[model samples]
Target: MTTSTKQRPEPMSVRRRTPAWAKAVIALVAVLAVLFAGLRLSVLPGLRDLFGMDTHDRSGPVLLRSIQDMSRYEAASGTFQVVVDLERDSKYLPSAIRGTRTLYVGAGTVDAYVDLGRVGRQDVTVDADRTSATLRLPHAALGKPTLDPDRSYAVSKQRGLLDRIGDLFSDNPNSERAVQKLAVRHIGEAAKESELTARAETNTTAMLDGLLKSLGFKEVKVSYGT
Candidate 1:
């Protein structure tokens, strides 16, 4: 009995082929991982430029408006800062129900100028020898307070329940008009109280003295009028 035992068929080794989409997806994931690592480590300096992350100013062209000749001499400038705490409340309601409060910090500049255009021939008196001179000038006047938007900002804002609710439905709900106006007023008052006009007068006097001395005037008298 030559019993040739049936040899068990060797099990075929099954190999599964990866799909094209799967290979592509794996490559993309690997590339994204590398990019994220580079970004986190800040190793790629040109990435921000490639991504266009820089600020672009798309403002329109600045139109030329009417121009006026400036004949006033800006002798002195004063910088002023003020804190404005403004609040509004409804008369019939409680503070928590109908009220708004804002704390704003404002910075501005005030210029003190002398109007040279107002000087007339009669205001300038020359002595007989033409060596002495007297000039009657107008007192230095303060210009309008120019608020600096870059330096001015709102520090805090608190709104009541009604005010908060109304803001959702209103356009420009976060308008700071009232606070800005108050800030400007306070800055103006502070500028008025400062010695900017006095400083301007001193500078103007020095300037005129130098100018007159160079013009061969031995005695230069500058008197200011109201």
Candidate 2:
């Protein structure tokens, strides 16, 4: 106890600190790794899309037969313009409650033609002297009407309250198709009433007369089949 007990101070512990540059290097490496991973994911998908590898083709080829032996000669043409009003409703009591209406304006042309193939060799008579000829042509027929897509358009449409709800549950009526059909029918009727057949016959006669006259025939006669 008398011996001045000098308490020996315990050796101070020393903690080593990492350098600032090393911390910065570690942070930079981590950022580079993240960027590299992002680039890999984005570039692979981009390349696939660019090369169309990610897309699927769901359509196949369509083939059609070639049309042959069709000799079409237009003899007359008629243009008709009309407005069609189409109305449809569910049958029975529902018709009064649920009705639909559509109006459309359509313009179209009807062409008339004569089939030359129907003419037989006997139908054409050439005099022995080759100075006169008589040609018999077939009757005129109406071709399919061609609608003007640009001019044809729906003018108005109306759907009743109940009809609107019914459309949600049932298939909707095709107003455009109905209107188109009506247009065709109306145009055809008008064309027939306009004497398109008579015009076609007249035109055909003139055409044949001119052609035969050009062939050194002094007299040419053209007649149409009944």
Identify the leading candidate in terms of TM-score: 1
Q: Tens digits of per-residue lDDT for model 1 on 138-195?
A: 9999999989999999999888777876886889888999988888888888888999
Candidate 1: C-alpha RMSD to true structure equals 13.8
Give a tens-digit lDDT track for model 2, residues 1-226.
Answer: 4778799999999998989999999998787557434454345767655655456889989787686887656899988999999888876646546787889999999999888888889999999999899988888989888888898999897776566556646665433788898998998888878889889888988888888789888898888876
What would you estimate as the lDDT of candidate 2?
0.82
TM-scores for every predicted model: 0.73, 0.66
> Residue 159 lDDT in model 2?
70
The 10-residue segment with the lowest total lDDT in model 2: 34-43
Clash total of candidate 2: 0
Predicted structure 1: lDDT = 0.89
Backbone clashes in model 2, listed as residue pairs: none
